[model samples]
Target: MADSKERLASSLLELKKYQEQNNTGVVRGSSTLGRTHLQRLVENGWLEPVMKGWYIPSSPEDVGTTSVWYANYWNFIVEYCNSRYGDDWSLTAEESLTIHSGNMVVPTQIVIRSTKATNNVVELKYGHSLLEISTSPASEVAFDPIYGIRLYGIAEALMFSSPNYFKSDPVNARANLASLENSAQIIRLASVNGNSSRVGRIIGALKNIGRDNIADEVLKFMQRLGYDIRVEDPFDNIVKVSASQSPYVSRIRLLWEKMRGQILSMNLNLSRIDLKDKDSVLRSMETNYVKDAYHSLSIEGYRVTESLIERVRSGAWNPDAEDTDRRNALAARGYYQAFMRLQKSMATCLEGDKFDLESELNEWHYELFDPCVQAGIISPADLIGYRTMQVYIKGSKHTPLPVNAVNSSIGALCEMIEEEKDGFIKAVLGHFFFVYIHPYMDGNGRTARFLMNMLLCSSGYSWIVVPVERRNEYMQSL
Candidate 1:
């Protein structure tokens, strides 16, 4: 037993050194220490197989979850392609446009162009695959400076993407179109290989998004180049473009604009409560406290029970007790605290008191994690603002925006919620986009639920409690 432990320790030390030296998670078989170290790491779950000879860094906690694979998807693609093709490959034009529009959701299948002869599909973990198109000319190729993945330039992506792509994903298409400062790149690309129909769609898309000046410039330039292009609008609807130039902000605004219509169309039978009758809602909330707390915490993977929720809510929870140090107990207490705080905010909203939307939501977040901070489970600094590090959703392909994008994106989201007139639209889109941005490191779901219920209660709709049994269905809907 002692000898086996010692050997495993040495192997771990060697693996640590290798990871530190390489400065990346992607590892190839030939680059690993010997068969013994590699075998040991795999058995202990320190490394996970990506394919036959390749591996990625992981932990035992990631055994059944796709988080590690999804988090490192782009990084592994970069390393694998660079090693196999030596700068001879780039992402497809449609894929490049998707990323260029700041839609970082992990794609189902990534198509690549390579100078190599064979066209093949390489299967990856968790149903993700790569479609390799053979012997294609890799023009307009550029590397993403941050992730090092090869892709097409924004202008080329716009010009080469299919006409139907503009209609299918208008948010991504519109955001990319709005990113252009001038028609210079489009005109340059169009002059050489001008397809009249394709160029016409580009002009129509630009004009659809309130970019008439650029549209006029492109039209005139194409006509001067002797292209008989006729204008055509590909989009089914014209959306008011957001004023902000930041792609992240633009993307969030577009998502809200697209979803708000659907939300309005829903047949939600909201029961109208009188504005002055805040007491009845408070009484009902107190009655459902245990059920609400139990389901909300349990859905978040907390080992919470109705009795534990009751103990916390009844003020029998002892902060200094050793039993209370358990994470589940700490979580129950925190949920209770945050629940109480939300009630107070809901009261103000029901009474029609003017409040700053951002400040109210921040207070809810602070209360949600304050118990964990007191227990030293997390730093108090974490509660000060938006998450400072990147966070991933378990078993999800949707990668939240980066740390730099969170602050401004969240600000834009709050402004939309405040300006929205319909309560259902506010509640539905508020919850959907909040989780989409994932502003906080932890408790994003819980915070989003609180936001949803707050809007619902203030607007005379009943408070909603998502049961733990429906956790899977609820998450999938998100």
Candidate 2:
């Protein structure tokens, strides 16, 4: 019995070694030993039965299974592909992007290209499917050293990917692209000849990068090769080239010109305010808050007063109270609450030595909610009710800018401000971009005024608040 137990333990160790070497659990050993040995291991909780004749080594941590088990599903596919096709497996363009970006936002249907004719969709655990489409693999498609899988060329990747995915938002797309470490790889792929049409589309698709020259070069090359082209520049209206054109190249050329201008006009600069002395800056921020809030509220036609703030904080106004005065009082209270929320959020964010404006804004939302609820400005029921109303009424509309998005957007704006040599453009665009993002749900106008004052203060310019009389012009400029 001791020798038999030793033999079983040896077999389990061998199975674990095999799985680790292959990065997969499926292993075919001697048939007689395999079935019985696997069953014993399963009974002993030393292995998990994934499928008939397929088992994975299990530990105490594997007791509560989750969707993360599906991650190993890719390893299974890789092993199966290698066994069947022998080192000829590759992911499709979209799948490659999903893997490259480490984005687990899995799509229901994953498109793949292969020399073999396969129409069958292999269903994965948790309703994911890998749809293998038949196509000739590009010559440039090669194994990524880091990921250990075949990847599509950048040009082919951009071209084959759905345009809607890239067009979700220019700012986010640009940020993602900029975050990529190997942008030159894409540029190299774009330089290829057969992919000119796709290259043109990608150039037009890129919202944030200054790639007009590259697009022009691509256009000229394609035109010389007798390919009809038209560009669709979606970034701005100033480029004079209309999307309406007969040939594709004509539209593409116009778009390229316009995109070039927009990209060039974009500011990319570091913030002027020194983040090192955060304490002193925060003290100054509190001082500026009083002045800015007063002016901002005055411009918004609110008779803002210290007494009004105190009343709001002390629960004199009930957001849900049926009385008309209660409603008015709540509105007044909301104004002060919003300002204080912004101030508190800013203070928390600036409290630490490091700058994390986004985190500060996110924290502010949770922190502000309790105070407003406690003060009777908003009931607990109103929170859910308002959120539901917002979803139905503004479902198709854009989300009102939250503080985190605003702060991140501001970080981008500050990048632009520092890069542009001209001070006038910096000042105007700085204010324009901040308000354009509309960070807060109700206090955007006030916040925009506050941001503008911050910029003005930094630049030695007088902090100018738009008067209530000039609200129309102020909004129009924004």
Candidate 3:
């Protein structure tokens, strides 16, 4: 066993050096590493095979989780495409628009256009595949230099995107459309082809999202070009229009407007709990603590127990005195502390008073991770604010918003929560959107549950416990 571990460690060191030299997760089978090293790494689950000769860095712990694959998906595409076709390929218009809008959710299948493609599909792990369509690369291709995936420029992507695309994914379409800083690109492209029908839909889509001035510019430009156009809105429905030019904010507001109605229509009973019964509520919450902490912590992949939770709550678990078990105890202690803080905030809401919701949430996040910081398990900087890098959820296709989009999106979501009158709606959408944005690097699931229960408590709803047994369904529903 010692010999095997030493061999595995040596192989991992080699792989790490290769990753550092190449500065990528992707590893080609034909590279300098001999077959023996590749076989050992694969056996130990350190490298995941993408195809016959392609692999990406992974770990044994990530065996069942698709997060590794999703995280490295773009890197594989960039490496594979660059190897096969050099600089001759670009993503299809629809995919380009999706990226341009800052929605990095991994698609089940991505279509690529290239002068050298053979019009075939390259199957990837987790049922994701790449379809290559043979076509002359567009002159207006753009590149995301960081990922090295070529894409259609924003204006070109919007112009060439199918009419059905606007209706099929109005959220991304609306976002990218709103991202057009002015009408110059649209006017320049529309005037070249005299595409009256496409122009008409673009004009209506612009007006649909409350960009009427740009819409008018395109409209007048087309008319002056001696083209008769009948304007038509492509979207089947229009959500609330945000004045902010940010696509991420626009997407959040649109989703909130669209989903809040459904949440309200669920017809949940949200009567206020009488302040006289605050003691009863507190006792009930105390009664539910062990079960709640167990499931919430367990669902987040923490190995915790009811006894550990009880010990932490009763001050029997001390970080300073329990060095041998302190690593395992961090999550329990942090959760207990954060939950207590949450209950106090919830008590304030129970009094029907306004509080700084943002500050309250930040405290919840801080309390949840502060124990880890104190234990030297993670840097204290991690708890400072929202995540500074992209985060992929386990077994989920939904990629959280990029770091650049985190701040504004959170602000927009908080404003919506404050403006909302119904507690149940706030609870439902607040929980949904919080995880949707996935602002934090870790503890998002726990924090989201806290936010949900906080709103629920404010409206007299009993504390809802999501069971670990329903973990799969819980993730899918989110």
Candidate 4:
């Protein structure tokens, strides 16, 4: 029999091997992982069971982590469905439209369709469940894979989606419809399915979004084929938001609209924005810099101090002689530099909101990393923009949008803020959504807090310094 130390060594080696092969730490219980191995992991606090047969890896220190469910939600579905039904399964029409609209939030109740599905709900952790409905879908499906889960193509999804989708997620529905780009696809599907009612709904949706050309083409084609059609506007209100037809724009708009309500009330103590009080504004910003920098850097896991911040601010920053000093000093310097730029931007927004925002936001990212570049810690090529690859939060299950979606999300966010007159909403949503988007690889938290403060400054509110000690509270609120 193996001794305790030998057994532990064997377990550790096996765990490493499993994680390496899978790439994701998630493990199926029966494959290379036995009940003893799993129980050992549970004892060590390195694993959490999502369902009876599924387990997700976690850090021993990270006890009670449920976001693991959200993080791996779709991946688990893909694996589960594929194992059970091969390629004979896909997301239901409504769920497919949800993904197309860029709402990646994990649903509490997920619905899938498969020819070999069990047609029953399998309960998972946190009250979420997988409801798979068996359906005899044709072998050939116009489908796409998002984060591994297969779904109907945008056009097919839009073509088959219920009117309830238009009511609940109109922006998403319209965005998916806009992804169709042409009436030919819809016309073809309508002809093949021979569903005049669904085709009429699609035509109405196209017309509602001002796609007169496609709607007219589709209408004429159906008329030519001797089919009587009536367009159906699903929403009670005929009004449409002035949104670009680009799917990215529509998705971003939809997500922001759905998410904004949660964070709008986070800061309600601020007075009305008085950007005219320039001296008062500047003084408030200056007074808060040391505390702000200390808390912000510390929250980001930087070992920064008041002394270090002052040293960097006082032009006494010389960290080249020592390696650790160099890294910490660079962090302090970057914070100070970015803070100064933020002050200037706040002042400009006070006078007018007409600055080149894209360029300015890019400059903010560049300023934060320029210090790191100078210290030879990061590549200078990335000095001008957001991360071009995926990023995951350290401890949270919430994943950021895909890297490619960052630009459009930021653009839509800025446009929303620019058009709104409410300083409070701007501060709250701007801060929450910026970090939620996680646009930048390194400086997202610092930048988000800076934005929140700047928008607060517009309302004559004092800077709300989130202390390092309250980092847990800050992140949880996010």
Candidate with top lDDT is: 3
What lDDT tens digits, residue by residue, belong to model 1 across residues 1-478?
A: 5597798888788888887898777889845778888898889888889999998888988875788898888889888888888878998878887776667778878888898726889999889898888866348786664477788887788888888888888888888788787889799888887788888998898889898988999999988878889999889888757445566788888888778877667766767776577799887777777888888988998887788788887878766667634678788888888889888987777777897777887888898888888878788887998888888888788888878788888898899998999987899899998999898889999999989988887887777899999999999999
lDDT of each residue in 1-478, candidate 2, tens digit only: 5586896787688676776776667543336246677666667666665544444455545543633334344445555455555555577765565443323233555555677737677665455566777675545665543224566644455556655555543332332333333334445555554564565565575422554544566566666766676665544322222221121222223323334457457764534556456555556655654455455666655665556555665666456655654444544555556556655554544453354433433333334354457666666554321122211101112222322233344454555555656444455555655445544444445545545554444443444656666766765554
Candidate 4 regions off by >4 Å?
1-24, 33-47, 137-146, 241-246, 254-270, 273-280, 298-308, 315-330, 347-354, 369-371, 374-376, 382-384, 394-398, 421-425, 456-477
Clashing residue pairs, backbone N/CA/C < 3 A, model 4: 273-458, 273-459
- As a TM-score, model 2 comes out at 0.45
Note each model's CA RMSD in angstroms: 2.5, 16.8, 2.6, 4.1
lDDT of 4 by residue, 1-478 (tens): 9997687667667888888987656677665677777777767766777777777766676667665566667777777777678888888888887776666777889887887887899898778888888885433455433466677777778777887888887877877766676788888877777778887888888888667788889888988888898889775555344445456667656556655655464644544535577878888899999999999989988887899899999989896858777778888898888888987887787777677666677777777777888878788897657788877776565677777778877888888877767767777778887887888877889888888888778666767899899889989888
User: In candidate 3, which residue ranges exceed 4 Å CA deviation?
Assistant: 1-4, 144-146, 267-272, 275-284, 320-324, 352-354
Ranking by lDDT: 3, 1, 4, 2
Q: In model 4, what lDDT does residue 327 have?
A: 79
lDDT of 3 at 175: 78
lDDT of model 4, residue 336: 87
Runs of candidate 2 with Cα error greater than 4 angstroms are 3-8, 23-33, 49-54, 60-64, 105-109, 144-147, 162-196, 207-209, 233-478
TM-score of each: 0.91, 0.45, 0.92, 0.83
lDDT of 1 at 54: 94
Per-structure clash totals for the candidates = 0, 17, 0, 2
Q: Ten-residue segment with the worst summed lDDT in candidate 2? A: 388-397
lDDT of each: 0.83, 0.50, 0.84, 0.76
How high is the lDDT of residue 124 in model 2?
53
Model 1, CA-based lDDT: 0.83
